[model samples]
Target: MAEIALCFAAMALRGFGGVLGHSYDILVVRRQWLSEREFAEVYGIGQLVPGGNIINVAAILGDRWAGLAGATAALAGLTLPSTLIAVALLGLASKLAGEPHVASAERAVVAAAAGIVLASGLRTLRTIREAGRPRLVAARAAIAAFACAIACVPFVGLPIAVIVATPLAFLLERRAAR
Candidate 1:
């Protein structure tokens, strides 16, 4: 039980820029607690469920670690700190709304966030390109993924986009093979 709490706390503290990013991957890939395939499966299951994916993943991992009690403990630990921080920030923002320095700080934070997002996207592209595949095939796959994401915006359903693209992606791979 202590071990479970420690594991959950470690993950919760280390996670930043959202859990779906490298944080979850670290738990699976670096720690060897779960295989990559297992991580992907758990992520998929989280997406299928209604609530936040990170919370769902935490719950799943917690349950795996120490059953129901572990899940409850993990969920509380994972959410409480962040929730408190959010509430504090909101209070501060409300108090500082008319201050020029506060507004400037907020804008700076937004710019930094944008920079981080751009860097993350480029890193992901580089990873895909370097994944031992032909450049042309990888490029095509990237384009297809981009198109699918765009289509998903109008459709408003990720599963529908996946359904539509899965066979198309397979066919593209087959064509590239030949």
Candidate 2:
């Protein structure tokens, strides 16, 4: 449990704009906690479920390793450090809210965050698509939908993109199947 906490804590600390990519490095490459395909599957499920993907992953992983106790530890470790930092940053941002430089910085941060999200989505999609399950035709539709969602987020934002992409993905998949 301690190890799980520490590992997740460390991952959280190192993760900034692109936590999922960092997770792939740590969990799949460095820690060897999961194989490539296993990480892909876990990440896919994490994304599909509600709330933050990484938090979901930590819970799933922690539970896998040590049941409920481990899940608690992982959640604590994953959230605590980031929460503290976000609070501190919030305080500073509030103090500087009216400054011209602050607004520019905030804009820059938003742009960067959007880029990170798009890149992370594409990376995860590629990983899932490469898993070599040709029989799962439905997976192709999902991949197309996810790709469209990623593409649209930078333009239309998430909710709208998902709303528009879902039906389009199914249509494309159906056409391809014919």
The number of the candidate with the highest lDDT is 2
Worst 10 contiguous positions by lDDT, candidate 2: 128-137
TM-score, each model?
0.59, 0.66
Q: Candidate 2: give the clashing pairs.
A: none
The most accurate candidate by TM-score is 2
The Cα error of candidate 2 at residue 43, in Å, is 1.4
How many clashing residue pairs are found in candidate 2?
Answer: 0
Q: Which stretches of candidate 2 lie over 4 Å from their true place?
A: 115-178
The local lDDT score (0 to 100) that residue 137 gets in candidate 1 is: 54
Candidate lDDT scores, in order, read: 0.73, 0.82
lDDT of 2 by residue, 36-79 (tens): 99999998889888799999999999999999999999999999
Whole-model alpha-carbon lDDT for candidate 1: 0.73
